[model samples]
Target: MSQPNPSTTPFKAEQTFLAYNQTQAKAYVHGRPDYDRKLYDAVLQYHTSTNGQTDTVVDLGCGPGNVARALAPHFTHALGLDPSPGMVESARAQGGVSATSEPIRYELSTAEDFGCHLSPPVADHSVDLIVAANAAHWFDMDRFWATAARVLKPGGSVIVWTTGELRCHPDMPNCAAIQTALDHMQNTELMPYFNPGNILVRTRYAGLVLPWQLETPVPEFDQKTFVHRNWDVGEGFDNELPEVDLDRYETIMDTASMVTRWREAHPEKVGTEEDYVRRCRRTIERLLNEAGVEKGQEKIKGVMQGAMLILKRV
Candidate 1:
């Protein structure tokens, strides 16, 4: 038989889904939530307050292009870059458009050197604002910062954010039990699937290297303007904050890259009692039963801690 295509391979250890096939991309697009308005406002206020232009915006590591779609209204031109071809295709199928009815473009590219090669040939130092929502931690910071310095105009800004571990809301019935179940589901059961990038996210990017920390420091970025912000659970960072039905919660958790890895690693267990998601549901359901949550009224809400880092180009 011909050698199996590497791109089609399953669960081979990778930094992060190196090849997000179409099915996986579609699942990601469906499962991920939009960033809350407060989150968007924080980024907008920082850039606008700093006199950053809004002509163009670039979203690096733009999985499924949600960030581009959400921020396109603020900029005349918006572009989303991701290394995965399946992700690019999945984004295009959304038909994302800007406030002026311009199409939001998604291109196949990596975070480190995306700006270096655009089909329309974006000029150096022309980009106004660059963002990487729930991304950035996976980037080669040295190359990414160098690329950011090259493409960002003077006073241009960059915003990056990521959500960390999820915790059950204290107000939920049998909340302690719920929390225990969630902790085991993520911290124990899924621990083996996590990669370095996932660990960076867990630390809320505190461990992420900045431009100045790199071996060859990129000096064009202004360290003085750098701002790091953290949001606790129920602080406008989580998607299903106040409440969400059990089904929606399942979908969101299933979208996690680690969950994908777990699924790939245990393909035979998928849809069975041994499946990670199924085990999670079983555990959560039993916990909910303690509170008499009714036969089918099961629901949950969580406080997911998150962090954001922002800096400006000199």
Candidate 2:
């Protein structure tokens, strides 16, 4: 089954990662937290329930191939695709492999075209599952769904998910004040860097186009087979960072793509007093200090709220 969209509309802004250098790519890999096993379990359960195979899986927009690596152990062939050459290199360097120890392949491609655009194009209807993790907002959904329909075998699955807003844990010292500081950074300092992709994620994917919701609608996927799931704080997939010093806190915040863009647009402000991350660090440090969590480790705890959308090919 497949779906198609006519006269597709796309997001206005391109991702900053597409221009990443090796240094930036490594930093991105370092900053990102690996998703939990539970989330993978959920995906697998949903995929297999519809009689989807564990033969070949393709990860689109796979940065550093994190999601691809996670699911690789279950499939015979695990292919990760991203448009960024740097990201592809990083993913390859990270060592991809399947459950049988067969090396996974990471290629330079975009979600809009994926594996089918390589030197040797992937055969049509050869893929068993296609997934994107926190990366779909940057896609031209109409094109992506069309390509997905072309590559996916009948009864295959498409699972896309993202971690959304950060919620400071109540147990953290001066949690409310810390939350306020975090909000200030996002709503103020990083406001100008907000792109359509960021807005989609922040809104819990409200604006993300679904397989069946395209302008022309894809008949291969049925709306009845769609499943939406929300995970609150403590769900593990929210990517909680429990108690961290100022350095760790800043590093984690800097990992955000929005923050990366903010730094790029204001390189002069980076590491200077005007730096958004520096200001947020100071505010959080002050609040933690006021709570007696002086210049040390694990001063606060927070979680990323998340949402998942599952679609089964008919």
Q: Each model's C-alpha lDDT?
A: 0.81, 0.81
Angstrom error of the Cα, residue 112, model 1: value is 0.8
TM-score of each: 0.91, 0.93
Task: Flag clash pairs in model 2.
Answer: 2-220, 3-218, 4-218, 243-298, 244-298
lDDT tens digits by residue: candidate 2, 1-314: 11112124445536688988777888888777778788999899889978999999988888888899989999999999988888899999997799889998998888877765687888889999988898888888878888888888999999999888767889888999889878876776677777778777887776688877777788888789788898776676834356555676677777788888888889999989789888877778788888887575436577677899888777
RMSD of 2: 4.4
Residue 61's lDDT in candidate 1: 85
Q: Cα lDDT for residue 230, model 1?
A: 95
